[model samples]
Each structure stands twice: as C-alpha cells, then as structure tokens.
Target: MVYPPYLQRSWQRSHNLTNAQQEALEMAVSEAERMTHILQNLLDLTRASHSMMPLQSESLILNDVVADIAEMTKKFEHRVIHLEVAPFPVRVKVDRNQLMQALSHLIGNAVKYSNADELVSLQLTQADSWAVIQVSDKGDGIPLCDQSRIFEPLYRVDPFGARSTGEAGLGLSIVKHLVESMGGKVII
Candidate 1:
C-alpha cells in the first residue's frame, strides 16, 4: 500500500503550484496507468497471500505472459526490454494471472533498476518438470550480502536514502510467496 518514492516526490514538488498548475499536474499523474497497475498487483498479492490456496489453476503459456509484461513495460521511455522466447509454447499448469503477477513484478523490477538505454532480457525455457523463466538486467546488480534477504517483506536494500528505482519493496516478497504457494520455487 506504500506509494513509490517518485510519486511522493512529485506530490511534494507540486505542493506550491498554482491551482491550475496543480490540477493539470494531478491529471497528468492520473493518466499514467502504471500506478493503477501496481495498486491492483498489490491487492491481488495481498489476497493471494492470505488465502489458503490460489483461487484459479490451469494450463498456461509462459511466453504469452512474458510478452504481455514486455508490452506493459515498453510504456516506460527509459527502458529497453528484449524478449527471447522459445519457438514452442512454454506451457505449465498454474494460475495464469498469478504467474503473470509474479513475472510482471520481476520483469518490472528489472526495467526499473536497469541503466538508461540498457537492455533487460526475459528468457524462457523448460527445465525438467519446471517451466523456467529468467528476467535479467544489466544494471547495478544486487549486492552479495543483501541477496539472501531481499525476499523479506518491506526489506528495502537502499532504505536509508532516496531510491533511484521506484519500488515499494513488496513485489519480490509477493512473488516468492505466490511461487511457493503453487508448489514452485523462485530463485533470486
């Protein structure tokens, strides 16, 4: 439920603007669909975490999920995301939306943290019985010491100061819970 640092900064920056300017700024902020998407994701993750089991389970194609996430993230002008999907459909039995949520969080994080004009890649393939999806970024990689606990709820790596990347720190924790609840595993 925490707003990203960018949004907060924007609000602060607009506090002294004229009425017309403030209204226009608010409208522009409202027009950005990413906030709505992130809020919905948070709500969905909350519901899933509290439920005994995921609500829906079915066979799904992971490539489609990756493509969808890429499409959404392409809206960010600063990010360059690349998709290397396998020729065949990478299918798995799971809740489509849940998996999409997990993948979206990971891919979104990659795009958010990546250096300007750098590429973020989504690679998908099958490994044994598990469908493997890897989202990689070429930005400042996670530090070795903090890697082990990044999945903990509300544990921000750069918590003491301003965050260059706008994240609420709940995304990865939610992904980990959702993946584990479905009897699958997520690696950092």
Candidate 2:
C-alpha cells in the first residue's frame, strides 16, 4: 500500500487536516498491511498462546534478529530505527520468527508514534537465565496513568485524536500473551 508522497506533503501542509488527519491518512493505507501483520501475529500467538507452538530450543544468536529488524525497518523511510546490540553475541532458545514478530511489533510501534527524525533503539542483553530484548523510542512515551492498561485489548492511548496511531490495540496485548505463553515476560 503506497501513499503518494505528494498527498502526504499536501496533508502535512494543510492546517485544516490537523495532525490527526495526517496520521489517519498515513494509517489508512497501512491499515490493511498492519491488519495482515496482526493476523499473522495472531496465528503465531494462537499456537504459542495455547502452548502448541513448538520451540526449536537451539542456540540462536540475538545479533542476527536485531540485524534483521534493523534492515526491515529501513522500509519505513520516515523513521530512523537504530540498534544498540551488545558487543558480544547473546544466545537464546526460542522460535526465530515469533521472536522477530515480537520485536517487529515493538519497532513498528516506535516508528508509528515517533516523528520522522526520532530515534528508535533496539537493545539486546543477557542476564542470568534470561535474554533481554528492549526496544525504546523517543516519542511521547506512554503516559504515566495509562501505562498499566496499555496492554489491554482495544485500548488506545489517544482514541479521539487526529494524530492517533490506528491500532486495534491488540498488538501489545498479543505480544504480552504470546511472551508469557512462551515462558518469557514482556515489559512496556
């Protein structure tokens, strides 16, 4: 789904559209693609959610996944997604695509909410028995009051705003559910 650059520029320049209008237009074309992605995620989550997803449990390199996400994020063009991987490779046991989906969701959100030039950082580290993957962004961070409920389904932080990112609000919920099902925890 391609949004014509001219339309985006015109929308961006229009005072009548407001920020929300611009966001809505950008999101409209992306909605189908995002929903497709969410559906695929839901399928993966269904397997993992029900403990039916098979875990390969091989020594997997974290750097590879981070690299893959960084490369994939390049398509966004409007955002600058960065990776701050540890100097050493961190190995873990997990399903590669599922993990990638989880990280992709994080990176996706970072890109969605952030301004074009903002930085989104993906960090990987190992501590004790757990391997940690953190994706942080410089966008208006989740509001203090809503932090607790951000993982709830259909929850939108800016539901009525024109600049709002159009999410079914299921991504993080699915991420949380899938992670816990996989014996890993998700932190916002």
Candidate 3:
C-alpha cells in the first residue's frame, strides 16, 4: 500500500516551495513509504511462516470483535465498510490478536483492490456452531487459475511487476499463516 507521507512535515508545512518541487517531494515521499511497507510486509511474512509462536486462543464474542474491526476499517481506510451480523450472537474460539490481524489484512485487501464507488462488506453469521466472517468486495478478482496458489508466500498474480504497488506479494500468505495458526480456514 502507498502510505501517506505523514512523516514528512516539511512537505506539508512549507508554503514557499514551487509547485514542481512540492509534487516531486510528495512523489518521492510516497515512493519511499511504499518501499518501506513492502520491506515490512516481507519481514512479517517471514516471521509468520517461520515462527512457532504459541497461539493464545480464547473464546470471544464474534459480533463484538467484528464490530470493532468495522470501526477500525472506517477509521484507517477512510472508507465506509458495510457490516452485517446475524440476529443471534455467535461465539468463536480464536487467538484474538491473530484473528484481528488476519481479518484486518483481508478487509484492507478488499479496500485496496476496489474502487471507492464499489461495495466492500463484512458479513458475519453462525453456520451450525461455527462463526463465519466473510470479507467481500466488488473488485477485480484473481484469475481462477491463480487462486489456488495465492496463499503461498511471495506468490503474486502480477508476477511481472505489472501492478503499480510493486508489492512483495506476501499479504495473503501472512493472513493465511495467522488464520491457520488459530485453526481457522481462509476461503478466498
């Protein structure tokens, strides 16, 4: 993701610079943040794949957790996320922190891949005794042929770096690791 250049105060504060200079500085800062994000995701992917950290699983109210996640999505993503919950509450056993990270990653991915006018939603329901949370978006989807391998670390649909972000392609892998660590499955 191209994170905002929040760290560069001079670019935001200085008014004396020429228009060309401002644009150039903003571009440079954005590029640097994107690169840094790639590197950080790479490190996180490695840690997720290699580490055998004990999962601190616990029972939690699924509705409450997803509600907090919805708020977080709106705040950080600056997008309105539609959320739906079953009439009855559902409880789930999961590692709270990992579940949050994985769901956030998936929801963020939806936002990243979709247009502002498109719909992005989180649907929560109880299937039998299981609590299910589905993150969906009306974005261009992965080719069916490549969908099977998306959870593999470093796998990218755009292998030729055709995508604008030049991402390291570790996002889904990290999400997979986090989810599976708590005995949860990712259906996408």
Best TM-score among the predictions, by candidate number: 3
| Predicted candidate 1, C-alpha RMSD | 6.0
Candidate 1 pairs with clashing backbones: none
Which 10-residue window of candidate 2 scores lowest in summed lDDT? 161-170
What lDDT does candidate 2 reach at residue 14? 62
lDDT at 165 for candidate 1? 46
Ranking by lDDT: 3, 1, 2
Per-residue alpha-carbon lDDT of candidate 2 for residues 1-188, written as tens digits (9 for 90 to 100)? 43457655765666777788778766665765666655765675566667776665556888887887887898755566677787888887777766777777778888888877778888888888788888888889899999999887667788774234545676777677666755789886
Worst 10 residues of 1 by lDDT: 160-169
Most lDDT-accurate candidate: 3
Residue 6 accuracy (lDDT) in model 2: 65
Clash counts for all predictions:
0, 2, 0
How accurate locally, in lDDT, is each candidate? Answer: 0.76, 0.73, 0.82
lDDT of 1 at 42: 73
- Stretches > 4 Å off in candidate 3: 1-19, 159-163
lDDT of 2 at 90: 84
TM-score of each: 0.74, 0.72, 0.82
lDDT of 3 at 176: 90
lDDT of 1: 0.76
Residue pairs clashing in model 3 are none
What ordering of candidates by TM-score runs from best to worst? 3, 1, 2
